[model samples]
Target: MSTSTSADPRERILILGAAGRDFHDFNVLYRDEPRCEVVAFTATQIPDIDGRTYPPALAGPLYPHGIPIVDESGLESLIARERVDTVVLAYSDLAHTQVMHLASRVVAAGADFVVPGAHRTTLRSRRPVIAVTAVRTGVGKSQTTRHVATLVQSMGLRVVAVRHPMPYGDLAAQACQRFETPEDLVRHDCTIEEREEYEPHIDAGVVVYAGVDYGAILREAEAEADVVLWDGGNNDLPFYVPDLHIVLADPLRPGDEAAYHPGEANVRMADLVIIAKCDSATAEDIAAVEASVQALNPGAEVLRCDSPVTLDDPAAVTGRRVVVVEDGPTLTHGSMSFGAGVVGARDAGASAIVDPTPFAVGALADTYERYPNARGILPAMGYGQGQTRDLEATIRAMVDAGVVDAVVSGTPIDLTRVLTVDVPLVRARYSLREQAPGRLQAALRRALGR
Candidate 1:
């Protein structure tokens, strides 16, 4: 909880991460600070990212050799071995109680635990920033960000979306990446998760910037923009301070606005609160979320946004048993039973929804074991090449068994882009449609002063 600076010479530090915020904090706070030394980073939440180095190119001049990234399971041993002075938690979407449990472990290990100050870690942007965040993952933050970018562009302002870090691949090579076209995604070797976030923005003709170093990423985005839009990841705060902070809440999962970590912080700091999926949730659930938001941050302007799921071709899955593949993080960490794929499948008149549990292979099998809520629907868990193969194999096993006739993909990116599926892959596309249209435009005008 403390962000105080200590002048202790060579204060050895270890960062607890899931490969995203941990890298950003180091880049902004410790990369250039001469008094502190980042001994190592511990990884969790994300798979296969540990056992790698942060790479010297992005570690700055302070570290001639890059820092080691280890498994968080070895926290105590590493802390004692390195004589660590501080341990920083840099990931998001954790329960407040779980955060404290990690803190307790660090304290018991004779190391100080710190959560970096949002202000200290956030970089200042030369251009005005409008951030779109959520209280949890899969609360329609992606569609909301697209809507914000499109609105800003309608005003003849060049807006570049700066996404939160998901640097699961090569750390040094992804130091500062700019994606202007679809080719950029392939050029950078983006994973399905990264593509799911980036491709939609690119399709909208909005340039997206994401990498390990947010300060450098901000500088690059600001050079060609009049406004910067922060597309936050996993309910984390923006890397750049925003002039207008828009936080989203999911009516489908009411009370999540107050339940998760940093999500509560986002609601407390919001300039506007948008309750997403109003059409899908019951009126009672919607009212509950609205009431919670009012109690938490009464000053924030409240609005409703309807997220409608539509399939590219309904006939493909009509009257057939099909396997549904939903967004990875949404089902696993977001703790959702189903997603747009399920809705779209039922809407398309699918006879039955095939549970991909028995057919799951490799990492896909491990995912089902870890998150039982994801039993019926397959989560698109492609963090690396091996996982991607597992996803493809899982789907193939389902199709080969002659149990399912089609595949319903609810992920933002096209499944055909990454995987080769033999059966007809029906795409489920969802977007934000404001209930009170001109109200959001009016708010945007006020925020930009245009």
Candidate 2:
């Protein structure tokens, strides 16, 4: 059975994840456990995150030789080569069937497939927590999180947001990070994704913390915050046991509330369910999602909200054929045809949304192949120098092709800061405002005991 005999033969565990939840699983679930040893981390989703080490600084003293981070492609061979006894699937946003496919492979490779429950990895925080999560990746979780932070601030509570970890760099240095200023982002060597999430919070005048060691990050956040905001990632549940749990469901993806992993768990556990994108979706779609939420979780309060896109420069968009660039994750894994960029562009009277497919290059080209949902918009994909360059080149090609007059970026951060597109690039921004306002405000008031 390959059961552990003693200290000499501990269970060699390999964790499968993209980067975020995988590291959190190890930190909270098995970092110092004497019965198991985390042999390696298999990364997917985020690019170039593999071929690195889960550095000894974060790996702890027992594992002086930092655990290796490898691509999930070699899962079977790595399982055999590392003598892995158990494989914990720690990432999020996969279909149940897809999750089971990997589980089948793990079982075939002669290792136990473990999916730790939401409660298993959740840490207890010293302060009160308000967690914002979603039923899917692009269900406007980030916007909802921003709204919660704003409400908390409105109440005059000193709130610090603990974003789900995006520690794609040096784990040791990123063990407990705080991003209060633009310099903090540069200091941490923040990637485009990290900046997209953190910069908005900083702009909102709320401090944000994220990194490898969430326990340490929580403590650091708790020291200053009257309440800690758990800004969740990729349909995963709150990393902390929350005093208030707000879950967002996308009307665009009606049945997904009960379909995906951990996300459905989030749906069941939520104190409040937000049927977001009410403005963009049809009545039937909204009712279907609301019905699903009600059927699955009748006790939870459901609020309807609209995510309206606003263009920074409406004049720049009107009467122009624009190359629209939406957030990368939303377009890729989130499987959306368009985001705020396309919506804002159309609303602003844009002549047409230029097709970036013809100009796609490198990972951007591969991204189109991987997820064909992006029909008229480009994904603002910039995981590294190569991807950023590819995005710039694609946008430039669209301009050079004379199909687009300007660029409209729907990412949270300014694309110009990271990439150089030859044409004028305007940003598309969106925020959550409840259709029935008292529902959200009242819920927050009760949660915070105001």
Candidate 3:
């Protein structure tokens, strides 16, 4: 490994990310710093994200040719080749041990490893911000955020939600996106994962903003809002400094609150700890999660909520052999075995839950190999056009073999909108129902003041 220092006075940096947080961190901290030159970004988690450039338009004037995104497996080589002075980790949903392992590798390769301080990177918002995050992915953050938005609107305040970045395609075009109608999603050519998060907000008549440059996104969102709602992604903390920080912990994954990297940090900083899915989780599990929360943040107000799962067309799945498709991020990186589709199927007395493994194709097959935790059911892993096609093919293969009679889709958005499957696609929905109804509103009043 070459260790010779660069002749230039500026420090060379390499950002390790899964596509979302890395760009935001660079834009916020180093874009115009003049002392740091970002040599490259290493990509992981999402597929087909590598081998692309950050695009000069969004990279600012310093990087005229733009920065290259290489595969994460080449981290050590890139560090040596670029003589990187610092390596910054800007991803989410990783265990503490996993983070340490990466740190050790960076140090061994003769580069400094840095996890940027959460507070240092967070931008101050002019509008009163209410941030809804989770101890891990699939902890019902979307439902909780929507509920908070409704509460703010009920007080006669105009509210706008800003989602965490998921700019998988065209960084320049996705610098700052606003979604007010279904047509906006089409105009942007949104993937299933993008639609899953943005469509629900649009359906509820709330305007949503997302994309690469959060500083630009925030300015636009703040202008139209009495309150800014930060809808966090993948167990990550909010990008904006929040007046009310509400963190959701899942009872199903009881001890996970203390196990993950930034997730545990979120627990410690939360103003309110919401134990979601009380109806689905057993009493013992619920108590275990609550005990962990109390141990972490004794001052935080804890509340229980039910995640009631229901099927839009129960008859489509009631007596049929069905293939259940759940939210991708929840199953793959979120590390959950099943989602609402499985629960709704069993509740509706489906004949049998067909295993989709045998019918997996291309990217879908690769996903199963990577995340062995996702079993029996299929994860809706559509990050790009090819992955979406693979998902469609895998489902059709199951139907062609006559293994399943219908499809149970538990994704937040309607799957029929994107895929044209041969079988009847039943939509399974889950929503947040607070156990102590008035408590959340009461807390909101205390934080925001009616």
Shift of residue 30 alpha carbon in model 3, Å: 0.5
lDDT of 1 by residue, 60-155 (tens): 887888888899998999888878899998999988888899999999999999988889888888899999989998899988999888889999
For model 2, how does the per-residue alpha-carbon lDDT over 367-431 read when each residue is reduced to its tens digit? 98888887567887877767888988888887888888889989999777788877788989999
Candidate 2's error at 49, in angstroms?
A: 1.1
Please report the TM-score between candidate 3 and the true structure. 0.98
Candidate 3 lDDT by residue in tens digits, 205-260: 89999999999999999999999999999999789999999999999999999999
Number of colliding residue pairs in model 2: 0
Would you estimate the TM-scores of all the predictions? Answer: 0.97, 0.96, 0.98
lDDT of each: 0.91, 0.88, 0.92
Q: TM-score: which candidate is best?
A: 3
The C-alpha stretches of model 2 lying farther than 4 A from their native spots are 1-7
lDDT: the better of candidates 1 and 3: 3
Please report how far candidate 3 places residue 78 from its true position, in Å: 1.2
